[model samples]
Target: MADELKRRLVHSSGAGLVALYLLADYFELGLTWPRFQVLMVVLAVGTIGLEFLRLQVGLDWQIYDKLTRDYEQDQFAGYGYYMVSMTVAVLLFDPQIALPAMLMLAIGDPISGAVSDDSLKFVKGPKVLVTMFVVSAIIAAPFLFEYPLAVLAAALGATIADGIKVRIGDYIVDDNLTIPIYASLLAWVVIEFVPV
Candidate 1:
């Protein structure tokens, strides 16, 4: 339980990046969208490099033993997927879409993890699903208030990503990777195609 709490806390810290971006933008600190995208890409690349070392080079860090689940021992840890997914979101979507999508993973996923039990069920319970949706919607609301449909779609996407553990062979698609991508993609679809 302590380890899970620690993991969720670390997961939530990803929101700091979004906060930094917002502050930089609001205060005109010169962190433009392109600059932020570059930063995300660099961070993702670095994480991927670290993952390669951890997986292929057998560089086992002590922190991994504490934070990672048994399943992650032989697979890409969530952080790598998180960085890659976030980079993809930032590069592919506008700030209005990317920021909330990132928040869904940073804020919503942590909250869901806090409420979840130890069981690694493929599908989370109704309680956890509802909690994820609500948290995700609230996270999206400030950025996407003008587009209610987009907000709904983003929330639903985040909920689905967090609620269901999609398995691809032996590796479960971590919600850390899926949440932002799913939210951004669904929100983009609604914003681009649906006239609401």
Candidate 2:
């Protein structure tokens, strides 16, 4: 499959599964803050595992390579970061908040990458990514958490930080920076707000 299509499938599938799982679990087990926490950990582990398998087996490396070029190595690093952030969010935030943030990472990040690669270019810095972040925040807010504004703000903030760290730095920023950072920030926001 094309990298863009693959990414879309991966992200949408992963996020959809997480959302479905959360909804089912909530209804079945009686929704609580702790359950949401557990869900985030579970989703992170599962998503990371799937991504690891895909990368290690070279299942999608060709497309990934073409899309990322020299920055492919950083993609693996991103996976680790994503796992850590998701775990933290689960431990710290409400599921309602965390899940939407996860969705942003899961759905928005990849979609943005695909869009940027095929349609938009970052000639003027991370403008494309920043725009993607804003759109993602707006879309994700209504579905993911009660404090949509706060979530959107957090997403925008993360976008800025990522733009600086990855797009504007002298050092190599790696192509994998987009999705991981986006997801991590969402996870962080979710964790921060989850009832403790």
Candidate 3:
């Protein structure tokens, strides 16, 4: 139980990364869209490089111990998939869609994870989805979501993506990756087609 608490604390602290989305809008990080996209790509590549180093040269730096608990044996960790997915989402979608999606990944996902019990069916429960959707919608509220249905769609997609894991061959899709991509795609599609 104590270990689980520690994991949740580490996971929830990832919400602080929501500041990455606000960097340009609030903090004036001077990160233009192209630069931000490039940065994300670089981040993904660098994280993958670090994972390689961890395997080959015994890379040891770690910000969160709980995050790396399975790293020693697992060839890939959630953070790597997260970086790659975020970069791809930025590259593929407009900022309006990408930012909210990334926000959901960074903030709402942690809320769901920290609240959901491991024994819950499908790694999720009503409580988890409720918290995830509410938090994701709130975070996206001040953004470019002109339609309520867009917000709802993104929130729903994020919550569901966070709750489920998909596997293709030996590669399992991490929630960190799935949440942003799925939410962004859903919001974009909904705003484009749904007359809301």
Candidate 4:
């Protein structure tokens, strides 16, 4: 239960990035795209540094080791993946593509995990996909009002990406990295050509 709570807390915090960006826009907080991009890059750098330390020290700074199985292994962790994905979205894509991309993974993945499959392995459940698409589309509605096709594509792409976890040699590519990138690419493509 604690693990679940912690997972959701971290997930929600990531989703809150969307709110942060939106609030910054509404209040004219001077968070230009370049500034936000630089902030994300700095964050990624810090996270990578901490990951290196975590690899060397092993549990010295692992406060959540007891919470989730994700932290149990002696390897690079998902928090870094999550941070990198979010950073890449903001840095590489426009706000139209980036914000929903972040939210799709941030909000959609946890919902998929809670009801779909909790196993480390990838499992594509039809109900899970549906749930993810619906939730993501709803979450993205406000931002993607002008592009229905792009909205659906983003939701579908993220959900599908979440269903597949890949392993390259010794490393595990968690959905945390894939979903945002895939969704952003899919949505950006759709928006670019769909006469929106």
Candidate 5:
């Protein structure tokens, strides 16, 4: 189990670091909505493709059997469904907000997962919640600084919604859902209320 967790942590962390670099570079190129959308489509497709390769090659399982053990067949299928849902949401909303929301999820969710897995001190529910909130807030800081309050509010709302979804047990709303929703809404609201 420990080995499996380590593998997952390493894989996810590497992915996140790469994503951060790409996103930072992309933003430096000029933070435009169209560019952000293109980036998201590429990322979404790439992640999906990687997951498919993992399943098809069976090499991922060999590295960590716990991947299969942790996710049931239906749960695995649900990942595809969730991805589709997120893609639709991004298409319908502003990618400026969506991008940051996605980043928050990308960064915050892993922090939560890592803490949950490794920290005996954070084993309690309150500790976990506080940790998640603090980590999420830090992730939100860049968005809040770059964008407006409305965008931040949207991101906050989305994060809360994701928390509710996870707690309710209807579906596992990963960072993908939480970050995008917040970012998108924040951008939308800011664009609506503020003048250019």
Candidate 6:
């Protein structure tokens, strides 16, 4: 339980990326869109490299033992997916859509994890799914107030991403990879086509 809480705490810390971007933009620190994209890309690349080192070269770090789940022992971990998803969101979507999407992953996922039953390793129960959707919607509301449809779409995307586990052969599609991507894509589609 302690390890799970620690993992969730670490997961929630992903929001720092959004906070940093906001602060830099608000204060005119020159973190323009391109620079922000570069930052996310760099983080994704670094995380991927670290995963390679950990999985390929057998780097048995202590933190890995504490934070990683049994399933992650033989595959890419969630942190790598988290960074990649955030990078993808920032690169592919407008900030109005992407930042809230990232927050949905960072904040909503952890909140769902807190309420989820650990015994069910794959799909969470209905209550957890509801929690995920509500939290995601609330996270997106501030950023997408003008487009209620977009907000609901993003929340639904994030909830679906977190609530279910999709498998391809031996690999499960981690929610950390899908959450921001799903949210951003859905939000973008609604914002683009649906009349405000």
Predicted candidate 2 versus true structure: per-residue lDDT over 1-196, tens digit per residue: 4764654565456466456656777688675657656766786788677668766765565545643334445455444455556556456555554565556656665655554545323332465567667766775566545655566655664455334345456454533334434544554555466553
- Cα lDDT tens digits, model 1, 1-196, are 7888888888888999999999999999999999999999999999999889999999999998887888889889988999899999999999999999998998899888888884878899999999999999999999999899999999999999999999999667878889999999999999899997
lDDT of 5 by residue, 1-196 (tens): 6754664464345335336535766778564555545655676787577567766754354533543335543234333433544554556765444444554454555565565544333123544455556665565566556654654465455445434445345645444444455556655777677764
The lowest-lDDT stretch of 10 consecutive residues in candidate 4 is: 64-73
Question: Tens digit of lDDT per residue, candidate 6, span 141-185?
Answer: 999999999999999999989988989997779899999999999
Off by over 4 Å in 6: 121-123
lDDT of the candidates, in the order given? 0.92, 0.55, 0.75, 0.80, 0.52, 0.92
Clashes of each: 0, 3, 0, 0, 8, 0
Give me the runs in candidate 4 sitting further than 4 Å from their true place. Answer: 67-72, 169-171
lDDT winner, 1 or 2: 1
Check candidate 5 and list the clashing pairs: 97-183, 97-184, 98-184, 101-179, 101-180, 102-179, 151-186, 155-182
| TM-score for all models, in order of appearance | 0.96, 0.58, 0.83, 0.90, 0.57, 0.96
Expressed as tens digits, the lDDT of each residue in 18-43 for candidate 4 is: 78778998999997878888888898
Looking at model 3, residue 109 earns an lDDT score of 73
Candidate 1: C-alpha lDDT: 0.92
- The predicted structure with the larger TM-score, 2 or 6, is 6
Model 4 collision count: 0
lDDT of 3 by residue, 1-196 (tens): 6655665565455444446656665777787788878877887899889888876787666553456555435467677777777787889998888877887876677677778775626457778878998998887777645878888888888888987767789666678778888888888888899986
Q: Candidate 3 at residue 104, lDDT? A: 81
